[model samples]
Target: MNKQNVTVNDLVQAATKFRDDRDWRQFHNPKDLAISLSLEASELLENFQWKDSAKSMEENEENIYEELADVLIYSLMLSDVLDVDLNEIVLNKLEKNARKYPVEKARGTEKKYTEL
Candidate 1:
């Protein structure tokens, strides 16, 4: 399949199939999935720990890719288990963030929306 043509549903189906093939769904409850997602994210962060962003990417690019894929896979699995629409939720969040971080007040600033 073309990478560019892949959708969220495609990812979820692939992840579920892989899980089902391994009989891993029995352990993929929402809580465990959430924990796995966090663990994967922490592993991804480990690639950058004590290293500049450029240096980390240069030295750990392959590991970063794998760790990030793990994080995304767990996120997809969690969303599937919860029956949540990932695309819709992400879009809704983007809209909410746009409101919170309007250009007029948020432009060129690192401040939180509440502080803006």
Candidate 2:
């Protein structure tokens, strides 16, 4: 599949197929998967640790991309294993957020919804 056209289902299928080929499903329970997801997120954040934003973005783009892929792979795996439809959930949350952060209140501010 073309990378630019890949869907969430494609990623989930590929990731799970890799796990299944290696007989790793036995070790992919929710707790461990969640831990791995958090670890990947931390690794993604590490690319910017103590670095100026522009310098970090310029110098660590490759590392950032790799870590982002790791994070998305794990998240896609988790959603698959849990039988959660990622697209539906994201859209649902967007609806909820729209109500909370109406554009009139959130357009320019970085404040939380409650503070807005």
Candidate 3:
């Protein structure tokens, strides 16, 4: 589905259905899901380990996509299990980040908000 057309609810529903089909929900508590998410993120990072961005992408594009998908799917599942609204939480975080890192202070810099 197109990015603009798909919603977080859609993703959560899809992930829930997949989990239910496999009877995997039994293993999907908040803690385990969080750990799975971290593991998937590390897998995604592995695509770039010891490689430049362009070369990593060129060599591992498919694996990168799959690992990233795993990360997102686990995140969706975890959010569903927690009964949290993903969009709401993400927007709330963005608002908080904006306050912490205003453009005037954060522009063109890689510094943390505290450093800025």
Q: Which tens-of-lDDT digit does each residue in 75-103 have in candidate 1?
A: 99999999999999999999999999999
Off by over 4 Å in 3: 1-4
Give the range where candidate 1 is weakest over 10 consecutive residues by summed lDDT: 1-10
Write down the lDDT of every candidate, Cα atoms only: 0.96, 0.92, 0.95
The sequence of per-residue lDDT tens digits that candidate 2 reaches over residues 1-116 is 67898887888899999889999989998889999999999999999999988888999999999999999988988998899998999999999999999999899899999998
Error of 2 at 86 (Å): 0.6
Instruction: Sort the candidates on TM-score, descending order.
Output: 1, 3, 2
The better candidate by lDDT, 1 or 2, is 1
How would you order the candidates by lDDT, starting with the best? Answer: 1, 3, 2
The C-alpha stretches of model 1 lying farther than 4 A from their native spots are none
